[model samples]
Target: DIALAFPNQPRAAVGEVVTKAVERSAPTAQCTAVEVWLLAGGVLGMAEEVGAETKDEGPAKKKQKTTTDMTSARLRHIMLKFQDGAPKTPDGKKVRSKAEAETLMRKIMRDLNEEAKELKSKHRGRKPEDYALKSERFTKLCKEHSECPSAQKGGAMCGDLGWVSKDMQSKRGGNFRELVAALRPGDYSDIVTSMEGLHLLQRIA
Candidate 1:
């Protein structure tokens, strides 16, 4: 979340380091320890500089006045549950173990990068109007399948599925088209293969 929050700076670097720290802490250590460390690091890094001319306010006021701006607020909101370390589902089942959680994180990060790559390709060519999975046939297939998650989400695959080409205007040939063409309804493509899963596609009308 911190990496997503600050894509281009020391925060991203620290976030990467902290992610490794969390991984090492698993099994015997709690993820909260990493969260606390990250929070403290962010606070220290974001602290306002104290100068001799601005020494009018007392230390209490200064501490109280240390503010987080919009980006920090968004980061905090997104990471609100990080300290809790992945909550259980509504049915009270544990979402994933610490190791599983780490794996999920890596998978998601890889997928995000793939999606960005496809988008970058689209930016260079003719951009297609973004389409979503809303076809009735697709919905019904998912609804009837107990194994598919889309069945629980009203038969629609999770958002994040979209088409992006290397050349937006010219759909000559690229990874995105090949990817969408490979879908077979309910089955998702290879993990982290495309912007979305490889086969998790629906006909966008």
Candidate 2:
């Protein structure tokens, strides 16, 4: 069993996606169960406080819950771990040992981090001239193809996402948030892929 935390609202949807991805990547027989823990009031400490406070408030008011209070609860994080037998390859062969599994997970995370770094480097290099040229092209594209499908379909359009916060940018798919955050206002990003599709984001303060 793997325990993950999710917002109560989208628990089902997030759980379904996570379960499917894990099952697809590892042998299903070895993976018996996937569980989600709905983290209320941010973190563990906060959750305890909410529970204690609610209990003290008595049963009458508890039944009359408000939407604002419910929506105010947000998921903090999801922790994933292997359960039962070790993960198996697509060919039905199990991973040899715990050490091996951990090693594999570490390597995968490392590679992902490295890829994010490389993407940032490609876009945010030291040379000023190259950066300016890239920004110019990005601006031109935004003007000429404001309604381009690639730019508009999934999330925000290609250019000027408008002073994106670090947290928001990092949440974008493909781990390109580091690249986005590193960019100064008016700096153009190289082509980046996230769940929202391809983006050529330019920071506009």
Instruction: Please name the candidate that would achieve the greatest TM-score relative to the true structure.
Output: 2
Error of 1 at 15 (Å): 3.8
Query: Per-residue lDDT for 1-205 in model 2, tens only?
Result: 1222222212232434455566588564444444444433211112233435445575442322111211111111111123336567899976454333333333332332234334445765443223332333333334443333333323223433434455665676674564444333333333344554334343333
Could you tell me the TM-score of candidate 2?
Answer: 0.27
lDDT, residue 100, model 1: 45
Q: Model 2, which residues run further than 4 Å from truth?
A: 1-139, 143-158
Taking all chains together, each candidate's TM-score versus the true structure is: 0.26, 0.27
**lDDT, candidate 1, 52-152, per-residue tens:** 13457535433322222211100000000111266778999775443443344344433433443344354444222231222333344334422333345
Clashing pairs in 1: 121-166, 125-167, 125-168, 125-169, 126-168, 126-169, 127-168, 189-198, 189-199
Error of 2 at 30 (Å): 37
lDDT of 2: 0.36
- Provide the global lDDT of candidate 1 against the true structure: 0.32
